[model samples]
Target: MNALSQTHSQGVVMTQAYLEIRDLVKSYDGKQQAVRGISLDIRKGEFVSFLGPSGSGKTTTLMMVAGFEMPTSGSILLGGREIAPVPAHKRNIGMVFQNYALFPHMTALENVGFPLRMRKTPAAEIARRAAEALDMVGLAAFGGRHPREMSGGQQQRVALARALVFGPDVLLLDEPLGALDKNLREQMQVEIKRIHRELGITTIYVTHDQSEAMTMSDRIAVFSQGVVEQFAPPLDIYQRPTTRFVGSFIGDSNFLDVTRQNDGLVAQGIGALNIAAPSQAGKFHGLVRPEAIGLWTGGDEQGHCVLSFLIEGLVHYGDSVLLIGSAAGLNLRARLPSVQASHLHEGDTIRIAWRENDMHLIPVQ
Candidate 1:
């Protein structure tokens, strides 16, 4: 099912679409399509992210929506009106590019006021609104400084302020935090989310970073090879991935090839696993998250599938440690709390267990 079809089942209400993309297609040559006939319905004031690797057509789709690129044959509807023929300048959409596309010579205030000046607003009103926009981004005092004088994070805030000063109906962010260092990138993520919350504008964020998309989006569209693998909320995409690509892309996963038998379902080396998922008849792959595996010290193993584990390597990640090992002739990765793993070492033999319902099933594809 597409993202929209799964929303109601997940208890999320579907309101009228504020931005509708119908069979949106884009092609350079007549033969190969960069973007296939993709469709989506986005509600107003929602934060939706387009997530994928490079050359996945996510940026192309965003450009088409912004009127920077025309669609080959499709419709882009905004507020129930078709806008595929509209010019970029007339669309009234705010855009923040990967690089903060600010003028080197212009002061921060002038950069923020450029949009209003284009529409021929009075000079005094431009100054007042520009100042307000700067203050909104927590950069009021830096207005006098040129782009060269500020830090990377500060320059990005200026770019964002400039985009919002005119109050555009939709905000499109194309990897706005790509240039910043890790700490600053995380800081900007929080700041941008805060601003989006306060303004409540319909937002389309484009990023290749899965963690960033997971943190900020109300829903994520996972694109791959000119199509969306799955578009759903963060947890849904992680817990119930509809495709093998999605299962590996979102987070760490271990997939086991399994088959159904007359007695029950069984993997090649790992005997019958007590998976309590809904029945779907066919060969399937079982998804087990590293953190879902639990260490069994002893006693009654009740309500768990116990298995022997041979530890081969260990990786310490401050709060948690990852145990790389072999279980039932298949490679396994298990995550444990730092305190619980303090005494564990490579070449150790141990027992691990996981609940029957914790094992998720995905059809082989």
Candidate 2:
């Protein structure tokens, strides 16, 4: 028996952690680390996403949790017991990859039943359970179709079914929707979120796409340079990012370098601004979300930071319009509803204002 199975056998009452990762570090050649001392505690049914750019250690951390990569130092506790020493097969963790990894010759039913069959399940039980799994993924009618006979989206559903067929303790997905087109990718994102809600299984999804992570995950761990820069709910990560990298990564933001003045904070071109945040006297970055900026329609500008925007370009996104402009030596992007932007055009100088609190601060490093 593995450590987890042995822990269950010992009848010791363990903590309520469905999954726990503590101080995980992965180093190659003992010089540089891929995952540097990251820790997270996941509840029994929490849906968490590891979001970051390529080679930012999100995938490396997921691999460590799935037992595909060994951590140099740390503990992965599943069901309140350490599973780092357990073999991949013994860990009871299911994984779905980007390529789908289905057998070309085997039908969807056979593919979904492969895991149960490997565990020496009865033929009758495998057939029944496989059908149920396919039904769960809305693919009951496509069970007899082989991988070559199915579309990319259908094949991905089959892969998801196969992963969930055995009712594993945890599910790990590594960029599973990357192969589909934009429309299909969006459709799959909804499907995955629905399945996650229904199953309520502890899941860790790895993706470089911020939209995908924000749409599906209950909470996101933003990875950068082998560290988790911020881990919070999607809206929290989006609205109040703690770092400059996170602010730039998650959404369209204008970061203005501000200097602390005797009265308050000031930017080079925008003059005196209302800064309610307290910080040391030094340089800091003010994060201005694009949506927070709107056209200044002859208001008093009291309690708000108003600036003159020299419009450079415009992008129409059907429902919204993106205004790319410059203000006070800072290039800014502002998103306005199409209705509001209809009267505006390129090269028009307009006043733009954002709330004082909307400007979040990240100290310059």
Candidate 3:
């Protein structure tokens, strides 16, 4: 059974998802499909991020799930029952946006109480719950301050409190922290994770920021042209990307276009040995993560695999240094800890090598 089906059987018991999308499809033009039949099962209390660049159809799919846009095909199962036609307010989904979306005229307290008021909650109870929500967001002292009176970060916290005041089972965020500066964004990312852990509410977050997605998602749905290219844990997406797009998206990588050779693909400058490349290996794409390549030492030394290179450039990255080199006519990059890189300098002749398993072979799609 799907996440929605399993969630509804227990009802109000705080089960996950209770919401799912099956073969969901959407299109703006009749001839061109935007979201091409996406399916997802979100468990209760899990945090999922739908991530991709602009035009990837991630936002469009998010709108459909939130009931703002209707899907052209397929079903939306809410608690195991179809809610494709369900009205927005009835879905009971909490939302926070990049703009903070707070009422400029109202104090944080009143702004947070808006949802409770709309639901006809008693005045006293509304105040009580709103204050609690503010407290949860570490903004209890800012309750009486209006949006204009608070800093951007404080306003964001107020927006978060407002979203949570309704106690919605699922929280939907649309680039909610995008407006913050780098340090603030990092701080809010931590805050958001902490909140998700504490509340245990299933969440759907959308963003184009890879670092944000990596730092917070329980599972990341990497989208490409409106389709999910990969959905996996952060490490898997970073170290074992299943596709070329994923390899380029999660982090920096060195790509070598190769042809099938014996048991492994033969890269231009680097020869190959036995390595169980992915099923799609023969098509001509090989991936080497920056960290996988290490300084090479030549000898007749035969082990896994090795490549000779001339170091062309080096970049310092605080904790590590990135070295750029050319191997067998292909450009390659290696990331080494600064401590280890301290001994190396420009134009150094180095042999870079990695285990056969360290390389990834990608399909031509």
Candidate 4:
């Protein structure tokens, strides 16, 4: 296991971890490492998402856990026992991929029952369980339909039923819903989250889509370069990211360079901030999420973290309006509710403010 995974006092072992990934490392060309020394413990019944950009090693990490990719160093524990050298079939982990990978010749019923049949399950039992799984995915009526006969979303659901019928220890998803349209993708996200909540299956999901990760994962392992930058709950990762990359990757944020001072640090163009966070001399980044800063239609800049900036633009985000403002040589992003946004417009003098603790410090390297 990686140092991070071993540091946990209690490794989650549900009905046997469904799956455990420890200190995984993978290199494609021998010199360039794809997956750095990464480690994560997926609890039996927990939904964890590996969210990162392409080539950031999220897929490789999942592959190593599933025995499709071998790690140069470290061990993967499934059911409390090590499985580094075990074959894929022996691992008994269910996997769902972006490509449905269903057989063109077989109907949905046959595809869903293939895994069970491979294990030589009784014909009667296989048919019964397959129907049940198909029903769970809302495809009971389309059992005889082939892959070509089903919609992208329906086909993906058949793939899900295929993975689930066997009741494997862990469910691994690698961009399983990427093929669907946006609306269908969103619907699938909710459907998957609902299924996970109901079944409490230990799941390891890999995706470069941040919104998907944030919406579905119980916790997220934010990967960059080749190593895991930070592993934290979604809210914590978004609100209080430990690294500059995490701040930039997880959500929408406005960053400004600052110089540390004894009492309060001086921001680039917004003047001094009265935040009480730790300060260093050289270079630091002040991160403020759009929601953390609100557009001020009329408020005096008496408190800390408040500034006067010209409203540059506004983008409506359904529930809230994103105000693009500028002040102190910095571009400000403030999110206000629709009601507040109605009162403000582009090119107006807009005031911006945040709480002392709403601002955080990340020493720039």
Question: Which candidate achieves the best lDDT against the true structure?
Answer: 2
lDDT against true structure, model 1? 0.86
Q: lDDT by residue for model 4 over 71-172, one digit each (tens)?
A: 888889987899889888787778999998999999999999999899999999899888888887889899999999999999999998888787677789
Best by TM-score: 2
Order the numbered candidates by lDDT, best leading: 2, 1, 3, 4
2 against 3, candidate with superior TM-score: 2
Tens-digit lDDT track for model 3 on 1-365? Answer: 32322333234474334668899999888878899989888777778999999989888888887878899998888667677898878887888888998989999999999999999999998988888888878887888888999999899988888887777767889988888899999998999898777667788899999988998998999999979998888888888788888999888998877677656666656666466555654666678888887776656545446767778999999899999888778788899999989988889977778776777777777
In candidate 1, what are the lDDT values of residues 14-71, reduced to their tens digit?
A: 3333789999899999889989998988888889999999988999999999999999
Cα displacement (angstroms), candidate 2, residue 208, comes to 1.0
Clash list (residue pairs), candidate 2: 269-328
Tell me the deviation in Å of residue 173 in model 2: 0.4
Which 10 successive residues of model 1 have the least lDDT summed? 2-11
Q: Which ranking of candidates, highest TM-score first?
A: 2, 1, 3, 4
Stretches of candidate 4 off by over 4 Å are 1-14, 279-283, 297-302
Minimum summed lDDT over a 10-residue window in model 2 is located at 3-12
Candidate 3, residue 89: lDDT: 80
What lDDT would candidate 2 get against the real structure?
A: 0.87
Question: Native-vs-model 4 lDDT?
Answer: 0.81
Model 3: how far residue 111 lies from native, Å: 0.8
